[model samples]
Target chain A: MKQLFVLDDKKRTSPIKVLLNVLLVCILLVAVFWLSLSAINVTFDFSFLGNFQVRIWQGFLMTVFLSLASLILSLIVGVLSAVGQNSKILFFRYLCNIYVGFIRGTPLIMQIYLFFYIVGTAWGIENRFIAGVIILSVFEGAYIAEIIRGSLLSIDDSQLEAAKAVGFTKMQTTRYVILPQLVARTLPALTGQFASIIKDSSLLSMIAVIELTQTMREISATTFKLFECYLFLGILYLCLTLPISFISKRLEGAFNYEN
Target chain B: MKIEFYGLVKQFDDDRVILKSIDFCDDIHTLAIIGPSGGGKSTLLRIIGGLILPTAGEIYVDGEKVSADENELQKYRKNIGYVFQQGGLFRHMTAIENITVPLIKVHGYSKEQAEERAGELLGRFGLLEEGHKRPAALSGGQQQRVAIARAIAAKPKMLLLDEPTSALDPEYTTEVLDIIHELKQQGIDFIIVTHEMGFARHACDKVAFLCDGQLMEYGESSRLFNQPETEQFRTFLGKLLEWNV
Candidate 1:
């Protein structure tokens, strides 16, 4: 049995600090809840939400559509860029490095602006969904590339050497041996990247996509109930994200090496 | 039917020559190359396996010159199976998948036949129980055994091993050597680079010594181990024996 020394030691590292932390968290929650209730004029009536559900449903569908489209684009870009980044030849690495650097170094907001206003107008593609999809995918692709490259790098060198020794052509080695492990190892990161994309989809409201946040904005403006609309919007966001977080956590646990 | 190297020279970047004028021929059952570190022993094996070409020299496998035509060397390579120091099992693949990769990728075997043969070979090696496990989940000895099984799964004519048992424990090393001996009984030729002098003395049909990319000595294993000829070979054994003593 392990000793309870850490719990017993109270001077520098005590349970008091933990108690204080919980107390602070409770106090912050109470303050926020109180402000929200008073500001929204709490009336215990959810009738507005009943009428609002239809628009919310449509907006949620659009959000899903945008997220799925962006995710597919991001995956393609991420994989290609990662392969390019780790290419044996120097020129390919340089090309991938410059692309990743240019995308990641700039702010996502600037990228959105470039896609929505500059490129979208020039190309005459006025579909906000298309512009939003392109912007989010390009932005998220940079981050996904790093995650993929990291997973690929983590693979053992002996693995590739073994494939070669077994008389696998380079393409065969990658297709059969390297790719399967790469996909498995990067799954959790893929989920995290998808979650980030969902959250960032709120940025589409600026371009008038009428996603959930936009619907909430329209409701709050009309009702003059900023706190109520946002409170419900927060609940909707939680409903979407909580399941993703729970599933990803379960995946991580299931695949954990318990040895 | 014969492989010989004449005036073979290899250098990494024109500065440090790893192998120089290595000249030898081996038509024996199991020929072992044993030498100290950085002695270009593995370089000789790699060149023989046709994984790398010598910067200057001629290598003939079965009377076909390797350096004369690049395409000819590739055809010769299909007959050789090289095993690395590490088992080098692909982590993503189970034992069966790893074993059958050569058949599917190189020999164009149908997946069903390849998998069936893989299962049979793995069963022969007493690894059927672990056929579904990935390399990461397997023990070092088991992974190496699986590697050996995979190497021979395609039924190559010659096996080239580079320090196959160096990373294994003493017991595992004996197990691997036992497998090699069993393969020798079936008349499969092997060019092994290893540091296990005991195996070199007992199991090998012939032994070759390499130093600074040169063939120091080559003879029957019993004669070479008992009565080493060259001064360099004698001195090398003297130091190794001192360590063992």
Candidate 2:
């Protein structure tokens, strides 16, 4: 089977070799941190983490929930938008193009601010969590739409012709022929997008969403352990993102249809 | 079943004509359309199968006029089976699933019924053991056989083939032609667009010669092959015959 990760293993690193390299890096990092602490005359203490552990855990849970909800909404929006973009009707195609253009061209932070300050205010929505999800979904949805459109278009034209020639209705063709192939082709990209979504959830801190980053900010301010709080936040993000990356790699391997 | 094409004209960008004012009718069970490359043979077949809309033309299948409406076209298409130059089998589906999908999904056959029918078709094509293999895993010949099996699974009134064996090696070509011949013996109507002049002569009841987006000749296979009237057809057949030799 072809390897999915595309990493060249011609210069194969042995397990012991990799372990030694990791240990060397870890030692170097530790040395640098120790020197920095000494230079600042600050004692490195992680005891402050325990004081705000529950609050941080709550924030972590909130981030996960927000990401999950936004992921689902974004996928729905992406699919609908992709279909709209690829629609035979000129107006629908242009409409989707403009939407993807506007969302993608603007900064995510700006879009979030616009949604929170303008759209949310106009709609009289006071729930910050809901607003955060909406913002993330719309922002991520644009990227997902482009990913889906690219993936769908990448499929050979003959596939659709075959489906139609086989007497499948347009919807049936999409449901049976297009969607299955589309899902397989788009999954790796979707997983990458999902990891981005999880990391970008940190941006919700600006809106007082009390997510992981927000919690880290509060902890750092109260306990005066900015470095430790930020480090923990970075580790938390890796915890969220690495599994998605690993699973997507595995899925790419499994769905390697060509091979 | 009878099929007719009246004043069929397919043009692109208002000037590039692919098929120009083709008027032909045939009631034969197997009609072979032979032409040079880019001669509009496949385009005519596609137009006849309702896969492509003619820029200007009317098609009648078994006395029923084909329409542009999606529902009507789908209904019309259900009665016709089309096999592409490439097998065009779904890459994700196994041969059995490829054959059975339309049976279960379009014809509303029960899963068991669809599978049984698929098994029977695969068995008939000497591909029973290969049913679980996807298109990429199958040989070129095996893929074409599965494609034909899938096309015929619904027992369509007419089968349209667009250069069905064009992509195959000689061995696979012979294999596919043999299957097509067998299917014809079973009284399945076919309109095959092919470069296989020998097969067209031997297997087809009628033959149409198209060139430069025009129907040069249309008549019984024996007459058209033996005594082609037009200079263009003679030149086309001369090249084909020289190539075959």
Candidate 3:
């Protein structure tokens, strides 16, 4: 009975393997740090971070707000655009196609600039954060649309037929059957797109948005510690992104029906 | 319930005719549609279930004409229970959830009521233990049982089965056939498109033979199988017998 609980060799992680993996990662990290410090001749001190902690924290909060807002807006845009692309109406399908094509073809930075300088100005939108959110949402919405469309297409035609056979209206079929499956199928892609959104929030610095990158740039300029400032910025971005990646992975596993 | 198809014509691109002008009306509790591959057997079933629209035709279920408009079709479809050959149970839903969805969503049963009904159906179908398992986790036979349970959950006027046991092995096919037989005894009307000749002969009251998108012959199962009126049906039966042997 005791033997029944013993893990098979394939399932077990040997202590030696675990120790070696940890050792390798430590060595690699140390080597990179030493190399960077030696090459730049910068002191390995993060003391300057304390002075700008509040500013950095504020910027971090803004970044989170921007990402979450853009993510929600983009998801709405994505689902609508995907549905438009899939619509039986020729005009709607073509319109969605043009939107997806134009966004995907142009550079995201260029789009942001265009939106801020021209569209926002024309619309009398003065707030930089709102403008940034709009730009990011539009940019990410196109890619998310494609992701959603691909996921929706991946569902078998029989599923739709089955729903119809059971007397589910087109709307009911989409809401109850297609949407649930689509959420599961697109969760990983959606997560990746969200992480991209967080990283892209850094681009708002160009438009004078007081996000993490902009704050770090200000700190570096005042202190003349570019490398250290950039390193902390990188760590800050990781702090924002790593949790999203981890949680989404857990969600992906939980939603996985294929297994 | 009586089902009637009047001058049913299905054509694509003004050239390929899947079904030519056909008129059929029958009062059948269990009708078996048997035909060669590429015949309009599945298409006919789909048309009846409102999954496909006929180019020129009228469908009457229980003497009420089924309209072509989407909303009207949906209302008409509510009275139908269609089962596909592949046992099209939602892969993400458990067997019980598959049955409960129509009950809760379409029929407006409360969650608890739907679950209770689902449990009763699962128990009736010998799938009580498999209720929590998703379609992927269930055997082919079990999935088909769940599909049947889901179809009949709404208590539709009639059930349409398209090759319900085609994907199952002999043992599983027998299991499904047994369930179908039991359902028939319960006074449920069924229109089945099937390749299982033995089950069709034994279970169905009427048999319709289709070939090249045309209904060649249709009559009582005893007369159609034992003393076929058409040469096409005779040849088809000979081939089926040879293959079975």
RMSD of candidate 3 to the truth, in angstroms, is 3.4
TM-score of each model, in listed order? 0.87, 0.90, 0.93
lDDT of 3 by residue, A39-132 (tens): 9776767897898879999999999999999999999999899999999999999999999999999988898889899999999989998999
Model 3, residue B166: C-alpha shift (Å): 1.0
Clashing pairs in 1: B1-B62
How large is the interface RMSD of each prediction?
A: 3.3, 1.1, 1.2
Better of 1 and 3 by TM-score: 3
Full ranking by DockQ: 3, 2, 1
Worst 10 residues of 3 chain B by lDDT: B236-245
Query: TM-score (0 to 1) of chain B, per candidate?
Result: 0.93, 0.97, 0.97
Q: Is candidate 1 or candidate 3 better by DockQ?
A: 3
**Model 3 ranges with Cα > 4 A deviation:** A1-9, A12-16, A88-91
Runs of candidate 1 exceeding 4 Å displacement: A1-47, A86-95, A249-259, B67-75, B110-112
lDDT string, candidate 3, B132-163, tens digits: 98998888899999999999998989999999
Docking quality (DockQ) of candidate 3: 0.71
Model 3 docking grade: medium
Q: What is the lDDT of residue A44 in candidate 2?
A: 62
